[model samples]
Target chain A: MNNIKELLKEQIKFTDGYLDKYLAEKDNPQNIIYKAMRYSVFAGGKRLRPILMMNTCKMCGGDVNEVIPFACALEMIHTYSLIHDDLPAMDNDDLRRGMPTSHIKFGEATAILAGDALLNKAFEVVSQYNGNNPQRAIKAMNMLAVSSGTEGMIGGQIVDMESEGKDITLDELKYLHLNKTGAIIRSACTVGALMGGASDGEIKAVDEFAQNLGVAFQIQDDILDVTGDEKELGKPIGSDAEENKNTYVKLVGLEKSKELAKEYSEKAKKSLEMFGEKAEFLINLTDYLIDRKF
Target chain B: MNNIKELLKEQIKFTDGYLDKYLAEKDNPQNIIYKAMRYSVFAGGKRLRPILMMNTCKMCGGDVNEVIPFACALEMIHTYSLIHDDLPAMDNDDLRRGMPTSHIKFGEATAILAGDALLNKAFEVVSQYNGNNPQRAIKAMNMLAVSSGTEGMIGGQIVDMESEGKDITLDELKYLHLNKTGAIIRSACTVGALMGGASDGEIKAVDEFAQNLGVAFQIQDDILDVTGDEKELGKPIGSDAEENKNTYVKLVGLEKSKELAKEYSEKAKKSLEMFGEKAEFLINLTDYLIDRKF
Candidate 1:
């Protein structure tokens, strides 16, 4: 567990550097929005998405440098979503990662533009990848755009917002989680595999691994919302219930949700059997993510 | 003027069909956001950006069919910007194109998400374009992303928001309008030329033409707000002053603003002189856009 923690910290630092290099505030004359973007991005995120992408790339024996732009792009997309999600018209949250949310620090309009800028910059960063495999880069970019769009994250957001304080079916809940969180996670692994030149079968396996891991990750989030410590979690606990959001914990109870999370985690781990020792880090990372309290 | 109006009406109808095909509501399981996206997109927009792109492509001897997806993507991006700009936190606009603005027709959250979806989907549509020149498509996408991002439209929006009700220099006003309106308009021309396989020199000329046209178009907008009829304009006039926005008319007075607009329009038309008769439609379109009542 400690080894996994060390790896996670190291990867986070590396991704932070890449993010700063790509989106440094000095390059932009419109400094305030850039500053706001940097604020949320450098706000001590776990860097789980980029790290997952990097590790999957490594597992497939690909050069990490080639995919760093794409990896950083995923993180930017994630950060933008968080900024918008915390807006007054959305979740209306005040704190994120133990710091003032973007809107709380900057004004709402600046925050909104910051989010928009980050999303646009994410595509800009990937589009600048003049790699040996421009075709692969274009493919990865297309998948990233699709996963972050209406059929994916934004679509899930609409459903989630509409379902608030209302009865939602288990299938509806699954649909929301799959698109909201699952889509990007799946894209992260798939892009990593594509950058690494993985075969179709191998890419399919990575997709399966990420799909289960994404659901398990959300289930853990639900569990933590019910039982997390605010000091460790950064934000306050019980926000999910306060928002009247449907969750795995809400539908299946704590113990059953825990069991389900474990099931999904196991499924994710099993998906790595084809990679054998090369996927050891991924297998351990799954356990670590499922065991996370924050 | 009547001939240009007929051409404009024909172009709008063509773009409307393309928008409907690309963003049809029935295609997505998340039906509400899709419906919201379609509503604002079909809200009687002038289709200026896409029409500019298509016409430039035609002037470059490029197949309009090959660039229609890119043309439509530009419109989607334009629509998304308008949707977000109309948010209560931003402009708080109640009406657009004589219809209720996005947030008025849909709820604020849905409107925001719909804007986000449209932005992402714009890139998706362009990415799926299987043109003969993949490199050109990628280059055009990069330019599109940059123009619509921090250094372009969003950047302009930030300054405009911050400068409201405050004394601003003509240079600052120029900078604001350049980014807020100029970036996308210039991109529409540049991308069209790129898709049409224009030479570097030709692309440069188109860029200059578009830049002058963009500034002229904005000045015309300012002039219209001060003096044009509300009925023909669809929305009420003089809302710029009500919003305390700084405009060319505010800085230079209506007569000077009109003269400046004419100067830019002439410059834009002159840039296309190298194309001889091939530029006839573009020259006429430039005049029509600058002389628009709506």
Candidate 2:
């Protein structure tokens, strides 16, 4: 597609409208936590996870509404992570999406509580998804929990933090990145596959598709750190490089890293070949995710 | 009645043992988030909330084992709240329960993720309720969510923070406290009633019992600040006073606050009057709550 910017902009519009609708805002609100939660959730992003889930589910012939709650839950979980990560004790980010971070806009206590509220609310939102496929819904929830919980993103975050300034093996870095970023991305596709009622074989294919796409996406992020602009990226470019992070780029030279990303992207595309030419969105997404600069 | 401390000690021991088993420790595990989660969860505490749930359930003829998961879920939720509260952007507390807080022990990133994991794990734990009461289980889950989420504790925390240095009306103060402290306490009893398979009327009674108890317990905390020792309280006794918090003792004099607490404690006991002698543990717990030094 020649209009990637326009498509990305439209997707962000959907994210804004849908998230605002789901998280109703009120004036003269009694609680500060609710206000802070609304602030972080609406703080704005491209809604990448939700878009991937919706596009993937649509490719598998599922209605978007059926997957909307889980889509929103993914965003909520992501937002909660950002809000918490921006706290002074963590990454200490002052600006997010070119505005004050949650801890900057709201006080630190309110920001922390807001993150907590969003986190608890994500499960509540997912649990409300009671369609004819109750078992699948439960399975999707279980997958979401495992990917988002201690064994996944949280685990990876700890490894990343602990490994900072200290030398770590390439294997350790890969494991950390896979769990931190890879697990949820893969889960998003698997969730969409299950939501669309994919056959067992198709479900397995979708899992591989997403897993490869996630690795490729992360490697692309490593590439971006070396070759990105602050304006395009919407945050400081090469921040990771400055931090001496054990990124894919750091472990392998630039040439090898690019080759690895290309290999993973091709693998991701091949996984969807089982669905034949019908999986247009999945195919384009795999290309778009790795090729995009920001 | 003097043996109540012995009972509390015994209950604390059992809760610590059970909770410790679930948060199994490892030596510098592969997953940083998992290790951080275990670190914060197994950090010793009084285990007051879960004990309240189990003891209340037991008083209502429910086997403690059947309710243990939900009981642990309460503690998980509590632990999450504490971790978030200890974040540098939150309460910024370095110590809790006479030990380093979660954010202090683990870095802020891991601490945040640990709290996030614990909160999700709490909901997953609800799936373990073996009481064969799906409706009750769903209801309990909803109650736990609403009380701990944006509508309850988070809401209360917001107003409490915003009300800092500003004069809040008595009505505002009451509403804040009700949502902040009362909601979860009320839900704890309701969860206990659900596990015990109480009749509708019995559940109603337990909720009322908890509401009264919550108000009384909060008032007692307000009083303890003015008249408590550091060793007995295990914290700076007058921190609330130092913070100039709008506590019951601040709004009304100490004598009147004590009277209000005593009045509520009496009403709390009367709410359980319907269960007659079968609710002895609850009655004693209510007495202990309102009269305890810490």
Model 1 misplaced regions, further than 4 Å = A27-29, B27-29
Candidate with top TM-score is 1
**TM-score of predicted structure 1:** 0.97
Candidate 2 segments exceeding 4 Å error: A2-15, A27-32, A58-62, A129-135, A199-201, B2-10, B26-44, B56-63, B107-109, B127-136
Q: Give the per-residue lDDT digits (tens) of candidate 2, residues B1-294.
A: 778779888888887777767666545444455566767777666677787788778777888877787788888887887787777765678987688887788667678778888897887667544445555565677678778877777777777777887777878888888877787888788888878878888889988998888889889989998897788887897798788889988888899999999999999999998898888888888887887887
How do the residues B54-160 of candidate 1 rate in per-residue lDDT, one tens digit apiece?
Answer: 99999999988878888899899899999999999998889887799998989888888888888898888888856556777788889899999988999999888
Provide the lDDT at B27 for model 2.
Answer: 54
lDDT of 1 by residue, A96-158 (tens): 887889999998888888888888899889888666666677888898999998888888888
Residue B87 lDDT, candidate 2, scale 0-100: 75
For all candidates, the clash counts are 0, 3
Give model 2 RMSD, 1 decimal: 2.9
